[model samples]
Target: MLPDFRVRQRDYLLEIARLLTEELDLEKLLARILKIAIEMLAGQAGLIALKETEGWRVATAHNIPPAFLSYLTPLLAEEKVADLDVTELNRMLKELTYTASMGLLNGTGIALAAHGQVIGVIFIFRNYADLFSANDKALLGSFAGQAAVAVHNARLYGQVNIEKQRLDALLDSAADGILILNADLTIERVNDAFERIFGRTHDQLAGTPHAEVIRWARDPIGVPLEEAITDGWPLTPNATLY
Candidate 1:
């Protein structure tokens, strides 16, 4: 039978996996990751630092003093957490905490990576000197794998949202009427000008067949709107059919 703590660990890992898949908001996801890591390790504090083009920066932290974060920033540049000298790190932490009037701290961290690319690092600190167990490292390694993927996904989602907003703004500001269509010629998006010219709102026209919404009168050449669109009929950018 599995030990009680082992069962709890399994459950937490499963829960974190669910969060990783469902949560797209970066801040909330990082907060939860740090919270779970600290709880699992019984740490006094923790932080997750992400590697950026400029360098490493703290993405989120729990119970860690803001002033001390800058001191930790340079430490994240190390390729792996295992490269850190624990005794020397602890000594430095002790001196820093003493000067800041905080508790003596010791910590363990793991590099967060996905697809063999290191993205970030997570560090959990305790007030005691007891070294982290092999089990602790193993659990953290498993958890960090999922966390790295989640963080990367959340960042990509954010970038996509930003680009979508920019596109929406550009579309709404256009002088000409615009209709975005699906492969089946259903209206997917209608710009503000299109809505105004047609006397219909986007909500009303969206998902409706363009043929049903816009009754296109044939030009002098008796060309239909569908054919004109398919054949690039206008012949010039500013040319109007009627």
Candidate 2:
């Protein structure tokens, strides 16, 4: 017979799936999952650690007392369970239990996996015996799947954002003013070079109509830029004005 908490946990797991499918930002998704996990498990603390190139980073945490977070630094840093297989994952969980026992962590730990790859781990601790039941483990495994996808997507998003920042920096360093307009002719982005050349910061010009910025200085043959993009004349000569 399943406990009432187990029944509630099943419902919560469904909610986790719904959130994972709807949320785009990984951080918020993970946070929500961790909160839900802690609530379902009745744990006092929860930590989600992501496998990084160097070490496991604490991506998100909940209910962890501030004092305990500071104390578990070494355990988190030294325990790299990234390359563990299922057998190794079981061993790692045992080790986590032993490690927690020594550090006053009375909870259950779960590994997050995707395509058989261990991407991260989650730990929940409480000050009670029978900290987790079989049903709790099953529910956590289900939630871990959703959490893994969210974590993977978040890492990819972070990488893309870093690349964009690098490209923006390079553009800002250029001598010529650059203006990026959307399909609707609305200004989307401008670099520092654009600000320097036009005496206007990107923040000031952003979302403004492109025509209001340079005033359609010149067409390809030194006519009018408004005529170029509009009448298909092409703004070739105006390129040298910057």
lDDT of 1 by residue, 42-157 (tens): 88888887767655667899988777877766654555532444344435445665566454666778877877777777888887878789888888878888888888899899
Q: Best candidate per TM-score, number?
A: 1
The 0-to-1 C-alpha lDDT of every candidate, in the order given, reads: 0.78, 0.72
lDDT of 1 at 210: 73
Residue 72 C-alpha lDDT in model 1: 65
Q: Which segments of model 2 are wrong by more than 4 Å?
A: 1-7, 17-29, 62-82, 85-90, 99-106, 114-116, 184-186, 199-242
The TM-score that candidate 1 achieves is 0.78
Error of 1 at 72 (Å): 5.1
The digit string of per-residue lDDT tens for model 2 on 173-215 reads: 8888788887667789998878887888878888898778765
- Candidate 1: worst 10 consecutive residues by lDDT? 81-90
